[model samples]
Target: MPDAPPSAAPVEESTEDWRRRNVGRLLNEAVRRFESRVLERLAEQGFHGVRLAHVGVTRNLDVAGTRPTELAYRASMTKQAMGELIGQCVDLGLVRREPDPADGRAKIVRFTDQGLHFLEHFRRAVVAAQGEMGENLGEERVRALLETLWDYVHPDGT
Candidate 1:
């Protein structure tokens, strides 16, 4: 093989320094912790069926409604996977698939009345979770971090 590129140097051993707790690991751990807290709050609100996986659908759901394919795209999932999740949500009475008016063959997934209520509860749960994070990281730091992440993720203002 030819020589490796300048940026392709072999990774060093993980010591007691930052290598052991790299950015990706730190971010993933923090997100899991945050999601766990949010799920706990949801459970407290009697939405025990809601899990972290459900967030992938709810987070990307449009206010009016959305197609399963669109939700899959937004959630970085496949249509089949999203369809299964949609079925699960429907079973839980969190959403319903209605015939799309614009396209007779297409279906639009919209939150049910129960789901609308759950959305309000979910919002409050998120606020409570953020409060907990703020308590740990200080209000300013947490908000700043959220702002940075929001900007980074929604660069197109979607």
Candidate 2:
């Protein structure tokens, strides 16, 4: 006679359990949705040629300009990858490489006039996105969520 298989136990899915299981996935989906919305808004505002991959570099760009190495580190990408993105941005007239005043041998990436215009659109889109998120999540929950994300990103409070 064949042995009977053990019966599986029923598991109750509580809210906390569900959240624990899905938070990371939800976070990634939220980011993708937010980025898509922002890009859509930018396109409506007349910005073009900006891809999702470019955000990895642009989001970490320094307002005063920064060295490629520093930007790469900030973006957690290799220098070669950053260089390629910078080259693309340069070709798009979004950025330019200028000789670093502090180091003659080095170059710093600075935004072109067009890039600054694009940045303005990006800023407005982000603000609109945040407002939408607040409306959907409620102000208090959005605030708490921002605080939690900040703490998670800066665990040492630096």
Question: How badly does each model clash, as a count of residue pairs?
Answer: 0, 0
Q: Top TM-score: which candidate number? A: 1
Quote model 1's TM-score: 0.85
Superposed Cα deviation of residue 149, candidate 2 (Å): 0.7
Residue ranges of candidate 2 with Cα displaced over 4 Å: 1-20
The models' CA-based lDDT, in order, is: 0.86, 0.83
The true-structure Cα RMSD of candidate 1 reads: 7.2
TM-score of each model, paired residue for residue: 0.85, 0.83
What tens digits encode model 1's per-residue C-alpha lDDT throughout 43-91? 9889999888787888888879999999999999899999999898898
Q: Which ten residues in a row have the lowest lDDT in candidate 1?
A: 2-11
Clash pairs of candidate 2? Answer: none
- Residue pair clashes in candidate 1: none
Best by lDDT: 1
- Least accurate 10 contiguous residues by lDDT in model 2: 3-12
TM-score of candidate 2 on Cα atoms, chains taken together: 0.83
lDDT of 2: 0.83
